[model samples]
Target: MRRRLRVLVTGAAGLVGAEVTARLAAAGHEVTALVHRTPVLVGNDGTPLEAAGVRCLTADVTRPRLGLSEADHEALAGGIDRIVHCAAITDFGRPEEDYQRVNVDGTAHVLELARAGGADLVHVGTAYVCGERDGLILETELDEGQRLANAYEASKLRAETLVHKARADGVRSAVVRPSIVVGDEHTGVVRDYKNIYVVLKLTTEGKVRSIPGQYEARLDLVPVDYVADVITQVTERFDEAAGRTFHAVGAPLTLRDFSDVMAEYPSFQVPRFVPPTSFDLGRLPREERVYYERVVALYESYFRRRMAFDASNTAQLVARPAPGGGQDFLRRLIDHCLESGYLGAPLPGVADVLARLDLTGADVSGPAANDANGAGR
Candidate 1:
């Protein structure tokens, strides 16, 4: 018995935003998808949002009144009953001011729009706001004076603070923090591969072979669909969501599992893990040092942490459990990457390689024969 709501989804063109928009529209909610540059939104399954009765509006969240005409703003404010604030610059290593302007200030403007419309607000934040702290992270926790890992996390923390204050001031607001979002849980398909995918691409290519990490360190990866479903449920059941925080996260996979899964793929180069304290950039070759400094270093924090997020609050409200994650899930992600040609075609299997060799002239003791036999083994 969910009442149909007029929903305005900011960052509608983004990874999570796109899925959320599609789900809202499919669930019969009146959805207005706000985009800054890319007005066209394609769902993870390649379904176009425009065909689902979703109105795509070009608006900038960083601007006052969402960069809309005063009249248009008023009209939109009067029309929508819910605002799902999903817009933010998620790129790591960006200038601090870039995060400040987009993640922090943009939220302020969204808050204004929510207030003007007397709408319930659901703010999409990140679980990493728990910062560099290890062990269990509860939805109830926010600022524990924890040292943040990057500017992106810091900016999200500030934005979440704004939402909490707004809720206290009587604007019905809730926060949903999702851990690392990947592709569809079932299909392993994604709109765009960024974040951890970048690291995977580099590592699997043998560009950065050694990483500062621990085998037992955990990485929590959630599917985009699960994140979207939770948001949709929160919107449909605002009463249960208001004043609460939920962690939309899957089961964590240990670094050992990640390495083991990659090993299973013959085409993938399994990266060697070393203790962070013992690792030094100065000792690496010039080319490796440059790659590490520019790309790998940004995600180095994720490699060493062993934090686990508590999702009890999310379990109570969500209809289904978060997707299971481990070695198999990691394999699925890599398999999809290979299938989509993102990671390039996988190396030829042992049978294919053997069939291509002419046994009559093939020197069994030579480098080529030895290499092929080693690969098959």
Candidate 2:
């Protein structure tokens, strides 16, 4: 028989967090949800989490030590047996300092909560923490000190450091790194509007005139549900799983192929996957280079990286393989987002108030437009 567990989940309203929390609840584990703000969306029951047997607590994750009042901290520490940390800034373009504060320092604070509760910690990290373009990114391997393309990776690396240190301090911790998470394979419901969705929307909005290549650059994407499933399954084996990291990535799918599926949407055209050297940057005027950078920065950042995410640990531990990858998966994802009205959804009225225009670019592939630090994980 298994012990009934009390689990606290950070980033409870996030895409992955929502799914994982729901799964955990379904398994009869008590779940405590920590949200950054007023929690509107609830679990699968279409009501408040408390109604679903979850204790919902609201706090800013970026606060020093999570800004928890004594009552809140004691409330968190008293009954929690495990913590699933899904909070972190995922946007690659956020200022390095901001990323460090949230992804790195924020993780330490979450660890503190877990420590106070004597709970095993499960942290959701990204596979890109493997760092800039190189060779195989192994699941069990880490901290080769790989060069980072942006701040997001750097901060996550710092966060991973914090979690590992906690493990060393007897926190009984484990980390999961997912690469390019997409929508559900069966349902095609994706709330994330960044990453590939940005590119697809731009194409439909006519931001891109030419793809410049056959879109053949190999890309990787994994389904979110699959990741949630793996997280749930792995957390159950905490004693052996502690201190381990697993990569939730699918088999390699090329960018061109990704676009082919995405282009099925009215806005996106099949990408041109010409070799990077095939296009001469010098031919463009100074301003065009800047403009081109805005238009293609996201694509460039991802396509420029050349490596495979090897998830042997994920496969071995979860007994599942990445589902619905490559071209078909991409098209289905784009279609779902478009039909769901997520792509190019009107910014909320307060976007002007909260909008960080300094971080946005005119091009679709530019930095994130909303709050998500990055796309799926």
Candidate 3:
């Protein structure tokens, strides 16, 4: 039998954090969900955490002692067995200072809390911390002297460095670095539609005509549920995962594969991929250029380089298989977006068009479709 541990999770309002909280609760673990502004501890389907017997606390990771009062700090210090530090600003457009304040400084504060509580730390970082380096990225690799794409990457790298330093100081720790997290594999339901969805939305809405990218560059995307599951497993088996790093990523899709999936939608404009070095943003019309500068410019590095993450450690630890990739999964995601009105209302007769194209399947839509694989809610 497994021990029922009292776990504290930070950033429980965000997508990955919320899912991790829910999964831990479902696994019969005592969970204390820490949030900043929003105190409502509800899952994606509006299920309250209290119903699952999970405790919710209002706190700030950027503050000393995580903004906990003397009584609360003593309680946590006495009872909390593990700390899952998932709180960090993930936006790319945020200023460098914001990234430093949240990702870097906030991490240090969390480390102090773990030190006080004598709790094992499970730090959630990003695979992009490897930065602009090419070839395979190992779980043990950090600070390869590679150029970062943005401040977000640089800040995450610094935060992971702090975790490593803490490990050396005798704080039992494990780091899980996930790539671009997307919707659930079976349900295709996502709390937020940012990152890759930004490009898909612009293209599907016919807002962008051309993009600067390499055709062969691969986009590493993983499902949020898979990431949460991996984290939970690591936390449960901390004795084995301590002082190690795991990559929670799956098979990546190339730019060509992405374009091919978009091509299936008749109304979607498949942007012509131009060499990043030769592509000029000034050549675009005013509206497109403005949108590119505001929304797409921050992710320019992702389209230009291909970075592969080696998840050998994660594979060895996780019993379940990783989520599937390729065009089939991409199609399911687009169909879910259209059905949920996330990508806006579907065009007239879009279902008929898909039927005529022979793209219909049992995994296309509805709750039954989502429940087929028992993967996600």
Candidate 4:
């Protein structure tokens, strides 16, 4: 039997963090959900974490002692046996200073809390920390002197380095580097529709014409549930995962596969992928150019490159296989977006389109089909 632990989870109100908190609570672990602003601990299904016995506390990771009172700090230090550091500004377009402040300096504060509490630490990071380096990325590798795509990538790399350095100071720490996190694998329920959804939304809305990318470039999208599950598992088996890094990723879809799936939907106009060198933004229509510059530009670096993440360490620990990519998963994600009204109300004649495509399986019709309005509850 796994030992019950008091786990302190940062970013407990966010998408991935809330799921982790819910899973930990379901597994009989005492969860202290640290939230900076929103104190609600609800899952995508609207299930309250408080109902699941999660203790919510308002605290800022950027502040000293997590912005907690001395009494709260001492109480946490006494009670928290493990710390899951999931709080970080994930917005790619944010300024460099924001990334340095939150992803880098915020990590330092979490490490201090872990040290003071004498707790094992589980740090959630991104696989893009490998930056512009192509080919296979191993869990053991941190710095390869590769060029980073954005401030987000650089900051996470530095944060992971801090965690690695903390191990030398006797802080037992493990890092979970998850690739682009998407919706739930089974239900396709998602709270936040950032990251890959931006591309889909822009394409489907006809906001952009062409995207500069390699058609064969791999897009490593993992479900949030899988990422959360693996992190919770690592926390449960902390003794084995100490001082190790796990890649919480799966088989990624190539840009061609992504485009092919998007093409299945009638409303979407799959953007043609052009090589970055040959592609000229000036050639685009004025509206498309402006949209690309304002919105799509933030993520252009990712679509242009390909990188494979090896999750062998994580695979050895988790029972389920890594999530797969391709048409089925992509369809489910888009369908959920449509059903949830996140992508705006489904285009007219979507039902006719669904019928013509014959894509509706028993699973697709289970819950999503019942919601005709595609509005969020």
Q: Show where candidate 3 strays beyond 4 Å.
A: 45-50, 344-377
For model 1, what is the C-alpha lDDT against the true structure?
A: 0.86
lDDT of 3: 0.83
Candidate 1 runs further than 4 Å off: 345-377
Best of the candidates, TM-score: 1
Give residue 15's error in model 4 in angstroms. 0.6
Candidate 4 matches the true fold with a TM-score of 0.89
Badly placed stretches (over 4 Å) of model 2 are 42-51, 210-216, 262-267, 273-295, 341-377
RMSD (CA, angstroms), candidate 4: 9.6
Candidate 2's error at 4, in angstroms?
1.6
In terms of lDDT, the poorest run of 10 residues in model 1 is: 368-377
Q: Write the per-residue lDDT of candidate 2 for residues 1-377, one digit (tens) a residue.
A: 66667888888887788888888887888888788985754532234444366767788778865888888787778788888998877654556788877888889888888888788899999998887757787877678867777778878888988888787677888889988777777666776666666656655543343344434445677788888888887777777677788887766676656655555555443434445656654443333344356656645657756688887777778866667546666666766776777664544432233355544344323233221211111
lDDT, candidate 4, at 45:
63
lDDT of all predictions: 0.86, 0.70, 0.83, 0.84
Q: Worst 10-residue stretch by lDDT in candidate 3? A: 368-377
In Å, residue 53's CA in model 4 sits off its true spot by 2.8
**Candidate number that wins on lDDT, 1 or 3:** 1
